[model samples]
Target: MIIEKGYDLRESLGVLWKNKNAAAIATGLVATLFSTMGPGLIVMNAAKSGGLTDAQAISWLLGIYLIGGLSTMFMSLRYRIPVVTAFSIPGAVMLAKILPNFAFSEAIGAYIVVAVVTLVLTLTGVMKKLVERIPVPVMLGMVGGVLLSFATSMFTAAINMPQIYGVMIAAFFLSMAFKGFSKKVPPIVVAIIIGIAALGFFNLITPIPLSLEIAKPVLALPTFSLRAILDISIPLFFLVIGVQNIQAVGVLMAAGYKVPINAMYVVPAIGTFINSLFGAHPAVTAGPSTAICASPAAGEKKEFRFIAAFSEGVFWVTFALLAKIIVDSVKMVPKEFTAVLAGLAMFEVFRSAFEGAFAGKFRMGALVAFFIAVTNLSILNIGAPLWAIFLGLLTSFIVERADFRADKIENSEAIEAAK
Candidate 1:
């Protein structure tokens, strides 16, 4: 039995390494790794900014990935969709904004409360109702809004680090050209390698002062309090559900697959509940990252995504096991490489959201949604996504109602003429 199990494991690795779908598979994994690492690092920094110690930050990182990723696996299985759920990056942004004043314990309390409320929303079906009411255009706008900052950052980085940026751009163009000949090597991987090499030659990378120490997660027990929930949970909830999930819906639908909103709600809730128990913040599906993975050109065969989830799960475990090496490697890589690489990887995400928000018979509604998300205004601490959908739906309803009335009048006239 042991030998058979080992053989199966080896076979799985062999299949992945020697995949016929190597280009697509590699693209998805490369993009996922790059995109997730940037945001994951940001979350760690945000935790630190919130006064969490290095150990706490590590715990938060490990816990978030484990809980969020495993739950996403089950969600993909249940929905038969290629959804890669994650903790809310915007929620982490909010934490960056709110943590200076509040205690980390309170932030955690709020996370738990939000998770509970989210679960309640799922059970009561209110969340599903709200999701259904949202129009596609508005959802696209919300997605665009979330990714706009990240995309803009790439250009900003190019200006800041011209040499590294040039290497990354060259890598992108070369990858695009080589793709016509061989579809195995991913552009993002090529970009990372080129960028690192360029930076190393320029003496930008300082040899990391290596200290060999194993970091272990220190688990904290949950202390749920109403005050903590009210202050922290509500804002975090609004950030994840409103901004994050809205974009997530847009990506799924834009790709010609409509996930049941209830499934969407429940998956994150499951992720969050597990995260809450393990002392991590709430989790949400990563629309931009998953969109990066689901590109048709990247060989996004349905099987590839399941393989991605399986691989990502393994990646997380391996990363955990070799935390020292992983951390060291991350530190060794220049930040400029990561920035441009991430933006390039998500180019498809930007294009899809743009098309979804502006194209088809839904142009007017989509335009309104786009404007609202770009404006980045908040109403009563609620983000722009809520309002974008609200306006899009209102406009769509009004136009549809007018069309209905006009059709009735036309039918009446036809009947009179026939009589």
Candidate 2:
């Protein structure tokens, strides 16, 4: 296994102090706000699907942010890179679909299984090889299939609460249309701020607990089920490896940051294992937040970017401590409103996944996978996403072997160039 050694807290702290600037701190704050505004609502939406009580959901929230925050700081300081990470948004969306079909304990079991599998890969020092072997188009096809509903849900949600959804949607697009404003304020924040005001004006906001409620997060035991392992764990594993960690690596690399890839896999695996015990999903080197933190908007000085990650981690820990407040806040809003926000939050990811799935080689296989996954089919307890991958690859092997050969040649040359 490739281990990143020589982490000195004192030196990293010194670097943070030396590089502290308004832009870096603001960038980190924006990343944190983006996560809480939309993805946080999505997390709540997914938990509700599993029928979790308030306390259980609070525990889930606390675990995810706490572990995720601490790990982000650790990895950034240890490697001097902007390592912004958290629980997988797409994985959580997929979980929302599968949770309705399985017990919560079984889902937790699947989470643990995924963490364990990734850890094993990390330890064996074959994580990169394993990830590289998966056909990118096929993997992305399955991802697009599972995530289609979350992005499309916004339209259906608007049908029910047109006023609130309309305001958010309008705000979202207006913010996206302008680049200067988007650098400071993310589109989701604009949408959410305006949407909340509209909600109050229309009296869509319900009367719920809005008082200080410190979270008393509790842990639960996991129950393993073969059905959930196949249906949930396998698909989630592919997402963490294929989508989250790998995507984060590519984003950072493009930003001119040479991160320790094995450490990236290993650290998130550790966080995933711990958080699953607290009823949270897999932790990952997150793509969206990493992109934000690594952007030039963070600061002109690339060396100081890790401080942005530090700022995000501190905010996450604070949010983790106030998980109950967040849950209570979500309760005050209508379910459809939150659903729309979550759906909108995932729109960018959905677009990327769709393009990656169908805009290249293995088109026929990806098409098959995409259609199969959209059905959310289940056979002998295994979910369609996993089957989508299998059948997608099989289709390619039979009728599109040339695509695989091309991919292999490209991968080999890339590996050689890296070496």
Candidate 3:
């Protein structure tokens, strides 16, 4: 016998568009993008500074953003957790230094190698052991240090344009006030509205210069060679493996979820492989980027974060497909206005990173981690995150071992007294 049944796609669809889901997903998307845009913009500028032409830089930016967003969607679904990732800021920094002397194709070759090594570690579970050994203090410190530069830039911009900074500060407080009075309304969104209005009121915003359109994407194939691997891959690996992965894992744990390291590594690594083919850099897990997906406003439902991530990919891809229009639209805003928002958005992340490191009993350990991260040392080609972890664990181990010995001696004395 055959059975026929009727189903309502609208039922499932309605749940997603309901007041709760709509508010949650909307808030999550806004927070994630706003917080991340600072770093994304910085990475774009870094690419330009590194000698990439406008076309090349935008191609890398949009490609990585799209690939990374989609990768997060898959991982979030598989893990049932909000695990968002992005291109490593440290890797980008390394690129800024190396790209001047080397060809872009050579850089792409290096990115591919990093992704391969990351995949092997994840598939073999070797990366999990390395992740487990990381001390919390070190992770916190590494995050704090990496984000420090951006935070400083906000106030620096305020100095450059006092009026814009003044408005931003007002917007920050207004956002806080709104969040307090109404739990549903997100402060960042409100702040953004106010910021834009302020810019408009003061006549500071630039008018549209030309019609906006999405620029064409330039796709390329990988050219792997021994020289390319040596020049690009090794350094890129040190930066991504050492810093970006550590901070992303820490952010997840801090938000009260402990995802398996393999999920974190493999998903983004695969995305990076895809990105490399398109002449984009390797993407890694984003700490602040995930915070948006993990926000309370994203929804009480378990899948809200994943849903939010899924939606973000949709929006970003849409924006990417209209790259020229999006770029042109952004051009209409004064450069200083973008700078102000970028700095303001990162404030929360910077605060949390420092707080996590120094606000506990492990303040001493956190301090050690901070110094190591800020120093930005390299050992055998490995970078600061790994170094911070090494120092933090070393400190913790010594302190614990000393306590263990002391306990043993005290127990022996007590046993003798009983005898």
Which candidate's TM-score is highest?
2
**Cα RMSD to the true fold for all candidates:** 8.8, 1.6, 8.6
As for candidate 2, its clashing pairs are: none
Over 4 Å off, model 1 = 1-52, 72-83, 89-106, 173-183, 211-215, 218-264, 277-279, 286-308, 320-342, 360-419
Worst 10 residues of 3 by lDDT: 1-10
Off by over 4 Å in 3: 1-24, 35-37, 76-81, 89-106, 180-212, 220-261, 289-291, 303-305, 329-336, 360-419
Candidate 1 per-residue lDDT over residues 285-336, each given as its tens digit? 6776566555565454655454454445445544444444444555666665
Weakest ten-residue segment in model 2 by summed lDDT: 410-419
Candidate 3, 313-344: lDDT as tens digits: 55556545554454455566766565566556
Q: Best-fitting candidate, measured by lDDT?
A: 2
Ranked by TM-score from best down, the candidates are 2, 3, 1
TM-score, every prediction: 0.66, 0.96, 0.71
Name model 2 segments beyond 4 Å from true.
415-419
Candidate 1 Cα deviation (angstroms), residue 363? 5.7
Q: Write the per-residue lDDT of candidate 2 for residues 277-380, one digit (tens) a residue.
A: 78899999988888888888888888888888888999999899999888998888888788888878888888888888888899889888888899998876
- Name the lDDT value of residue 215 in candidate 1: 46
lDDT of each: 0.61, 0.85, 0.62
